[model samples]
Target: MTTPMNNKNSLLVELFVEELPPKALKKLGDAFANEIFGTLRKLDYLEAASAKTTFASPRRLGVHITHVREVCPDIAVRTRLLPLQVAFGPDGEPSPSLLKRLEKEGATLAQTTRAFEQDKEFVFLEKVAAGRSLRDGLEAALHVAIENLPIPKVMSYQLESGCELPGWSSVSFVRPAHGLVALHGDTVVPIEALGLQAGRETHGHRFEAAVDPVVLRDANSYALQLQDEGAVIASFEARRAEIARQLAAAAVKVGGGSVPIHDDALLDEVTALVERPNVLVCSFEREFLEVPQECLILTMKANQKYFPLLDAQARLTNKFLVVSNISPDDASAVIEGNERVVRPRLADAKFFFDQDRRKSLASRVESLGKVVYHNKLGTQGERVQRVMHIARGIAEKLGDAKVAAQATQAAQLAKADLVTDMVGEFPELQGTMGRYYALHDGLDAAVADAIEDHYKPRFAGDELPRNNVGLVVALADKLETLVGMFGIGNLPTGDRDPFALRRHALGVIRMLIEKDLALGLDALLQDAAAQFSAIAGFDSSKATVELRDFILDRLAGSLREQGASAQEVDAVLAPFPQRLGEVPKLLAAVRAFAALPAAAALAAANKRIGNILKKAPEADAHVSELLLKEPAEKALHAAMAEVVPAANAQFDAGDYTASLQTLAALREPVDAFFDGVMVNAEQADLRLNRLGLLMSLHAAMNRVAQLERLAV
Candidate 1:
């Protein structure tokens, strides 16, 4: 494997196997490539800045790394030996322990003793080792690369009689391995992987290949040879781009100026499923369009791996694009075959929709009892009742009887679609099908819209609810989940939130803060807990605190994601403000206050004042005029007397930035008071008076935000 006097060369490694799991293909490819590339780079066989390309097809995973050396460079390594005390005896001559260490290090007495004495603390043996050959490094790299693959599922299969045991030769991998190829430029590296000797040959498209096993010429020619001779596009990303471009072209040829469905996961899955992708236009019966576009699109993408074309307005059309592995002279058969295959899928969706609509959404409410929400939290019917109670209270908080009635209606019918055939077939369409059925049931549009939008902002960056009714019900639904889950002690631990409690909490936070709903988070949680009165083993008082902290923790993360520094968010969130809507304003106030010239000095003074107040005698914000002895104390008192009232008024008027910025005016007097006067004075009256002044200043500075947290 040492090629042409150990010159640098591009390297290639390919492992041909059965089709990989589509979802895990990208990760598996990346992990395998990085593992091999990183180990070689660490050993100095490849540089950090070398160019590498990862290729993942349905049947193969490969990597091509440039600027890889045939032999790694020699390195000097220091090996630690015994401690300093053992290196020398009391007689000051070379100790017997030192001589044994020197023998193991293969060093002379004079040289080893001189080198060891310089450091003396710990004896370190130094040696210049020869670089590794490419064959040896590649063999080790292959072992590591295969072992570290992020395989979603592993299989145990029999190998072809290579093991030491008599009748037991088995290999476990993501898929059954067939061949291994390792090339340094044009040279074949002498190594074995998965019981297969290294070779330049790999199988390509099983049916359409020009040759049985594509013979790769060199590292640089692998992709081109696969494409030209083996009829396969070996690069995953290149094949994906080609499929996308062809889909767009095929949609244009259909004359509707349509666009294929834009789903990244679907695209990635299809890319993993094909070697040579030929996107062809296909169509289903136009009557299938009467089914919900989501149902058709999902069935096409999920089951058939087809891209349903949509018009410019993003409405599904009858036409779709199919990525074919074998590009026949006429793709008519492939197109019709896919069209035939998808017809039954679309028919089933239509059947489910029709069957679901024959009965009203209201009729499905009682069936929710058959569905167990959680063994501890009772059934879905009971959960609906809890959500209904919370929703009604929120609606009443918002307005009169009309809003409350609508909210009640929406919350009651919210989970009814869970029992519908359409939703049962496709669990993802739960809330969506509910909306369609509600509208079909002659319910008000607002009620129908609420059913759909209740699950809004389902994931990050998703849209929020459409209207106030939806907002209230969404808040109630999420609150009920949090409260019930917490009451049952099903709190989320690290990476194990089976109920997605964090998402539910963030959803609730998003609705409350975004809608500026008048309900406080604590009030909402308390009401939700009350609805679970019949539940056993529920401790509402404790659960409510946990719920508040969990939601506020999510809020801090959300705030940080929106560009608020951790310090600013901590300052605003320390008090856990009642109106979460005002949190953004408070953060803005902190940011604005922090930008002020006196803000740092004021924050530090506030921190010092807080410490002083904590240690001093308990006192309210009341000062004795006669007890003010120092000039700085009198000035701070006068400044606080003026600033506190104005700041309090601004806080009451909802100008948090103005409130916090106004307190910046007292920075000079605060600095003077801390520098010139002592709060723990000799006289009791003076000490209490100074403490009172500091308390008043501290309270004023922290009303809008916790200024002490802003202290460096």
Candidate 2:
């Protein structure tokens, strides 16, 4: 090891471990680096212009921070003592408590009395405390960062006892750690963790390293040194980018415009699995291609972690790419080994597909009884029956008898693929395989397509269901889940949503709005709840209202994600617009109306009107012709007679923006009425009349949205 630099230098810390879980490597790396940076900065070791670079590989997580001070400067500290009143008495003598406190702090009465000042309410003392050593700070920081890692699961292992006959002691971490390296500038920081003392020694790739303990010379040279001598790409993102590059180049070599499957998650996993990435092309027999490409691709990716290459048309080619940890002089053995490993996986996929096809989805329906959807909600078979009934109702509302029958049939068969062997192995292929089997069983093409598409819009920004049958079934399926789950009090809380109710809610919202379905939201939910009416203690009324609220909350979140501001979303969604398809138009009207010169004043005036109406006696919003004694009231009344009709006509035609703009004419009259008229006159008739006029105005202004919510 080299001697330490005197002043500013880079800082490096590494935890070398056994192979880490690929799924959590990125999060673990980010958390570790941030924790170390935060700790060092708190200790005043980091400069303002310093930068932190993180490195992570299959075997290690490390960070190199520049501009860290070798030693923190001395800091001035003020210690608060007793209050002046308690430290001194009116007789101008030190209190006994003050004497004891000063003695406990190793301060004399004369010095403590000098610390008291008339300007300060509390007596204070000052001292210059020596700064912490880098070794001490790093020890605490390493302990905290390791303990705080966001590890999915931790393992307990036996570490050999120091200076003994290989006696074992237990330790717990994400993985069994073997080495730690903490260097400041050119010297070791003398930190210890994970039952090991810090050093400049860390091993590289298991096979391809030029050095065993890849001796890191200094903090700033860690990355380059690893690459040069150890043959390991130490940066996770850099290695991932390299893999992506090689995968692309290998795809081009296939010569058919083919490319590897574009999956960021798969790319990250592959990066975490290898220290040195060597991309190789391999192939299997084309006969395995007879199986669905989804099945083959899923097996290749999920089981073997291989990326299947696809042609320009998005069809899977027999060729695929593997990311190997070793790069040998000749890669023929590695390529052959990977290819051989993947063939059996693909063959297992084909065998499952073939065996599943022997029985139609219709015959597998009886087997679903064994699958429990939820303990409280009964079996999947029971839920399927409920979905089928709700789908028929929704279909009948959307189309004729034939359409309704087709929808029920699709819903009946949607969950049938859950029992298939291919889907059993790959649960993500549920709806996809159902569509294929439906076609094989000679079902109508519409029914087959519906089986596949009912689970569309699976996530945010995903596509909606394709056809009318799909719309009906998707709506029915999602509504059944929402109603049943909410009925059983399986509501989602802050973080836990075991059933993915949010995704289902968003799916329902996307289908309704994207398809522009004319089905009424409340009516659909009520009908869904009524199907479970026979179940003991089911309340259709309460469930409908709760389900509507739950879905509306999801709608607000979805609308905000689509670029609607909070005010715009609140204005449109506050009333729980059951005709959600019309919400876009309402928001557009609100946005356009907000931009007009008269919007703010009108919004304020509407807010004033709402406040006035809420406090007044209960009265119908009807103005008696005889009670319009004030000129402002009569003028506002005449204006409303002209504008309300035209605005109502526009609103009826779905010209929401035009309707709101027409109400802009009310801003002047509204301002005059509020400023010139007292809505609460002593005369009861006059007060009622004014309240009525204000109520009518409030109703018209909020037809498109709660315009008052836009008020500053």
TM-score of each: 0.94, 0.93
Model 2 segments more than 4 A misplaced: 1-8, 82-120, 163-169, 400-402
Error of 1 at 668 (Å): 1.9
**RMSD of candidates 1 onward, in order:** 3.2, 3.4
Per-candidate local distance difference test: 0.86, 0.87
Clash count for each candidate, listed in order shown: 0, 0
lDDT of 1 by residue, 285-321 (tens): 9998999899998888889999998998889999888
Query: In terms of TM-score, how similar is model 1 to the real structure?
Result: 0.94
lDDT for predicted candidate 1 compared with the true structure = 0.86
Residues 424-543 of candidate 2 have per-residue lDDT tens digits of 999999999999999999999889999999988787677777788888888899889889888777788999998888899888888888777788899989889987876666666556
Q: What is the lDDT of residue 31 in candidate 1?
A: 85
Indicate the worst ten consecutive residues by lDDT in candidate 1: 1-10
